[model samples]
Target: MYINPEQLSSYAAKFINLLIDYSPKLISAFLVLFVGLYAIKFINRIIRKIMEKRNLDPTLTKFLADILLWALRILLFVTFISNLGIETSSFVAILGAMGLAVGLSLQGSLSNFAGGMLIIVFKPFKVGDTIEAQGVIATVLEIQIFVTKMLTGNNQTVFVPNGALSNGTIINYSMQGERRADLTFSVSYDSDIKKAKDILLEVLNKNPKVLQKPAPEVFVKNLSASSVDFAVRPWAKNANYGAVFSETLEDCKTALDQAGISVQPFTLQK
Candidate 1:
């Protein structure tokens, strides 16, 4: 269809006026979005400074504050989009569905994260402590977000899931300022008990690492099938534990053997 020039010019002028009418909404939407964004950023900076002043762990403070900041920014985004008349129910529904699926898939990981929080709160064992947990002996290296790192006595690095550690038995050797030096040695049933006890006392007395305050105890604890067991308990500083334990056991055996007491032999294997 052919149109007259006057009619076309009138439509063009009306279209320009309509553009002018909507321009304010567009600009306001943009201005609100940017202002909200900057405001959120400024609040996040404030939270970080507060956490720093409180001497919180930098990693944890950053992580928690970032999560809060993002939540605020997302709320602003929903408000901004709504100002432009965009419905947010469907968007929220989509997020909920995705969150449920992700939570199901990462249940164990989420539990570990929760355990990490508990660890930070309770602090049963800090980094550099020697501990025995679940029969695994190690020195704590780092307390991370989801797992704890350790250096084993054998010089191997190990990572334990935080949840497992939190629920399992933990023996922090470093917690006790002093440790009992435990040693067990078997001798033939015919050996002299009094002499053995005397020798053990002598061994402990000579060792400067041993603590004299506890008063070392020596006993013939058991009469095994092949030999008699003596449980030697001596107290000492934790720092000298391994050394004292090793030396005392070796010397006890050697001195007993020199006194003509032979350690009984037993073969359980055919």
Candidate 2:
């Protein structure tokens, strides 16, 4: 440890020179990073407002805003690195390769994400809609990035993957504003067909939930080995479908009982 003062001073000078040369670039990079982050936030806010003004779906709005924010951040990251005199081509290439690998590993998740995007864009169904898909009939609670959350009639929460939902057949009962309730009531073969039909029609007409425009219809649908089946078709607003259906069935049974008609127990077929 017998270093000369001249050599020590030379090392100190070189260190100070290096710091001096890099300080401005470092400061500029930090400044760019901070400003870029603020700009991204401001841009995201503006975009959200625009989407709201256009009355876009809330789910779509959030998804699009997040995607844009991340994209801008990535670009800003590249700029920040380049300002520090670091080459970014290799960095971007690495990012691309990583993204590709992640994408390949998450094929199903990516499919679901794509499906969610399509649902948001096309709007085959929306929140609060009664949709039947994949053998589940439930009200849509939330349309997320990879799955659609639903509330079943029995208070069960179901998550349906958006990939299968978008590709499969979706029956949106609420989209039409009105739904036709198809009810089948079975009675003894000895019951008077005309009397039973009239009684069912009367019950539908009296019910406030049933729509009067489309009118209700009751007809002999089939004759089983021991019972007669009557198809009762009634139309009601989408919101009142469940009420109308259940109420009509109960009222019809009561009416038949009062009219000396024996109702046969029937099992509902999905």
Candidate 3:
């Protein structure tokens, strides 16, 4: 075989020319990537400030800002790649296919994520609120992307899926500044109804935790063959509900006993 020095020289010259032509484009892509990342951070910070000024939910605001920043960065990366002379249409198609496959595989997780978004946006309950949902009564500890953490009355931590929580009935006990404690006391049929009512009202009035505005009420709620039930309802600040309720019941019992009132014994219905 015969080798040609002129042909080898020409091939080297072509390689050098191609590298020279692509150098600026490669550098431009790198510069664009750096600027794009900085821009994304700045945009996210601005969004956070705006949401905070509007008093938006912290969970929702953070989630939205993160999603927006990532989407923008992804677009920027695609543009950067295109500047390097790569066709991005096929790349985008591949990404779309991957996304669809991931979505299908994580249906439940996606549902929970959506539910968490709804929870944050609508705010049926917030952190520190005492709520009952999905058969669990607890104080909300944290609202995460896919689940909510709560502390139960017994001091147990429970993680509830946002999917079921959003769809189920939720009772937010702390939404209102005040809550009512509905307590019942039973008296023997032989006891005086008016006397029992007065005792219960006195107990309620003396309790400092009970709210004075709504005014406590004690009335005969039910009359049975063996006992008469009196309803003792008192309004208290949500934070003081447990203390006020327990104290009222104890005070009512002591007052009734001192006043010679008899409580009815529990009897199974025939």
Query: Which candidate should be chosen as best, given lDDT against the real structure?
Result: 2
Kindly report which residue stretches of model 2 are placed more than 4 angstroms away from their true locations once superposed. 1-17, 267-270
* Ranked by TM-score, top first: 2, 3, 1
Tell me model 3's lDDT, rounded to 2 decimals: 0.89
Each model's lDDT: 0.81, 0.92, 0.89
Q: Write the per-residue lDDT of candidate 2 for residues 1-270, one digit (tens) a residue.
A: 799999999999999999999999999999999999999999999999999999988888988998898889989999999999998989889989999999999999999999999999999999999999999999999998899999999999999999999999999998989989888898888889899899999999999999998989889999899899889999999889889988988899899999999999882422
lDDT of 3 at 83: 84
Candidate 1 residue lDDT tens string, 212-238: 889887888788877877778888887
lDDT of 1: 0.81
Candidate 2, run of 10 with poorest lDDT: 261-270
Q: What is the TM-score of each candidate against the true structure?
A: 0.68, 0.89, 0.83
Error of 2 at 236 (Å): 1.1
RMSD of 3: 4.5
- Choose 1 or 2, whichever is better by TM-score: 2
What local lDDT score does residue 215 receive in model 2, on the 0 to 100 scale? 89
* Candidate numbers sorted by lDDT from highest down: 2, 3, 1
